[model samples]
Target: MAQIATAAPGWNRFVGVSRPIAAAILGLLALLMAWGATSDVGRDHVRVATSSSPHFDGLVGDHALYARIAQRVAAGESYYTTAAAEHRAGDYPLRPFVAVRLPTLAHIVAALGEKKAQLILLLIGGAAISAWYRRLRTEPDLPRAAAIGALFVAANLTQLAAREWIFIHEVAAGVLIALALALYRPARPWAAMAIVAAAVAIRETVLPVAMLFGLFALIDRDWRAAAGWLAIGLGFAAGLAAHVAALAAVTTPADAASQGWNGQGGWIAYLSFVQASSLLRFFAGWVGALLVPLALLGWAAWRSRLGLAALSIQLGYAMLLMMFARPANFYWAMLVTPTLFIGLVFAPAALAELARSLRGENAPNRATAV
Candidate 1:
């Protein structure tokens, strides 16, 4: 909310806001950024292991870890065996399968090979961005700034996917979420549900998002959408239950490792970047920490109908982080912030529209605004 401008058409064409309100949100964002940069809620993690558990080996840069898992799976070892050993080596929790990663990425990469698997994922990401662009074009008008922002978002996504974010499944989840948003038409309920199911498989954390989406659709009285998503949610919940039950059955009491934390730190633990063993990773963590408030603001000001689902997922994940944050958990922000960047860069205009409504100005009416 730095300034008022909406230069796009269709979904985001109404971003103009008053300068004073824009300034206020920006000021708040800046203060939060400053607080994050200065605070050290878990600085002790920089000097020593913050976990109280004797077995906690600290965070493994999961890129290499995942690659190793794929290699092991390719070598014909059972996933549970390889995963258990890896977790034991890293001192990650095993009881109730807290640290065991979902098998989607590993299984896919093992069967398809790294290059080919990533290529398919990249294609899916591109398709999702293209779908959003097409939806924007059908709006009958386009703002220059909004158009530019759209292009910027797409380009940033491409660059991010080609880099570290692509190594993670959540990157695909972001793009799939975008695709789900683009395809959420009354006539295309099945298509949207399919995309969401794929996304949840890629990253199970998105299960809550699917549930919230159905809840929103129900509120809208869109029976088809609500029913379709509800069907997918039930299916996903059942699959997750089966998977967890299988893991639990396999693990004995000895495999149940203690999950520990730095009792001293609360949510502010995100600032203690230096605690991370890798200099580059810690730097990325700091940047992600700083972006959190701005992302929250942008998510708040977003005006798309799909913004309801996006915000629900974004806020839900943020609350989960707030409730569970530790020194290592600071990096989780980075995992979730890529798609959130789409909202952050084009936020000013949406803030303006929201402000206008508050001030009894000519606020945007969805049917005629674009």
Candidate 2:
């Protein structure tokens, strides 16, 4: 009996030592599942003799356009003139066109080809997971909880959206946005601004998130942070103006309408559609089983002031989408998912408290914690 007890201690030590390895393995498995889903969609695009599926044809088309731009550039055509002229002539939406305008990434894709671009995007997805993990490490109060949070965020349906829609700039933009927000309190304003700029360049919808961050900075009386956010906003506005000017120089007013600028009203309506679609796709299609528990935790987290602010911003963004965009797609709400998941990080603790209360040990204290 003594020998058996001694052996059990060694077994326990092995299990403890292997915990991290197990977690890492699980995390990798989750990522593999996400990658499989993205590859499935990519393969479908190939099967259809297109670069995208029906659900995300916009992204595919954007990639194809980028490829064409790359090809033209490789053939000694001027990028700004040829690509800009083609963009003015095409029916591409403003957001996607702006994303494709990333000169550096565009050149790389042009040099390497679409398959290589897809591989790079996959790496970016992994980088996002690493960023989240880093963010958790910085939060001393949340260190132990960070692993679970990272896993959840990394494997969530939203991350899948990032992978599947690789052609769109939003995936990279979203990661930047999250990293910026995560670093904001660590006196990393410049880093944060860089991310905000990238997100704005990808999609104008990031403006709301920037505004929310600015509001938080203002409330905290952090003038530099507030100023940084203001600069980001101004930069976005300037970019938008430049895009509009370029469009005007190359295309007629009728062409603008065909390109999805049927006045601000139509834009508003389309944004709303995108927001609604995002919610349905998240809840009903991807991550369906985990939604309820996470949502409950998010609600609980909103009791904190910062948490409430985040929730409010998320809701406001959703409303903005409803008001301004038409043909709303689910992925448009991708930015809101991280904030939602951050709030939901408290859910596991809540569950533990509930379990403790049910066992009739320190029930009152545990209930209060919940």
Candidate 3:
């Protein structure tokens, strides 16, 4: 019996370890299936349409700009000169111009075709998901329950959809921005700043993210880290200013009409209709369906003093986006999506704790079970 008991404990420990590993692997498989299904759908739709139509083209203007930049790099042209000339000529859209100058990611996408670029993005998405899972595993309040939240965020439908469509700045930005917030707890402030910088450069609509990072530093009373974030913001502003100046100098006022600029309000209206058309189309629907339970887990974590500040920062940024910006698409809010998912992860754990407390008060004589 003694030998059997000892072996049983060892067996239990092995099972405990294996279970989480199995869960993680399963979660990853789910993510891959979701991604593959969406990608196939997108390919089918594209195949049916005329390739010459701009709408059917996988990577349009900015994508073409990145390709040209890569071709120039392959031919031994400096990145700055190539980027500057493109800016002056108004050869690419504003968002792509900013993204292409960022060297690391731009070069990678430029070196590879659009399909390969998407695979790279999927890898990054996987990394972000894995990071969240790691963080959840260590959480004291709801270590086991947190996995549910991690899975929800990791295999989010919108993320899967974005992955299939190449050249999505918001999708990439979401992962990087989440990574930065996740890093802040480890005291790796410089690394966090770099991630935030990359996110802002991808999509200026999420500039609020840089400010939120600064706020996190201040709230933690880390002045040096706060200053680092400020420096990144200043650098971004300077580059943007220079680009704007060049654009202004080269283009006649009337040419702005030919630049294919659509008003943001119209885009927002279109996005809203898209959201109404399908349950899956609404970004929030994914949150409600898959992420709400995880958010409850996050709420539990917040009560336990694990991720409160990050939660606050994310919520504040979301409110700011809703009020101030007419988002070009539902994905513009991607920067906060991970944080929101984190919140979802904690929500259920928090509710469970609450239920236990209420039961304890209401039925003091009854045995309480976890």
Say which candidate scores most in lDDT: 1
- Report lDDT (Cα) of residue 19, candidate 3: 38
The best candidate in terms of TM-score: 1
lDDT of 3 by residue, 45-110 (tens): 111111122422344444444455555765677656666555445433334333334544455555
- The 0-to-1 C-alpha lDDT of every candidate, in the order given, reads 0.59, 0.49, 0.50
In candidate 1, position 148 carries an lDDT of 37
Error of 3 at 242 (Å): 2.1
Count of backbone clashes, every candidate in sequence: 11, 19, 19
RMSD of each: 6.0, 11.9, 11.2
Q: What's the alpha carbon RMSD for model 1?
A: 6.0
Better of 1 and 2 by lDDT: 1
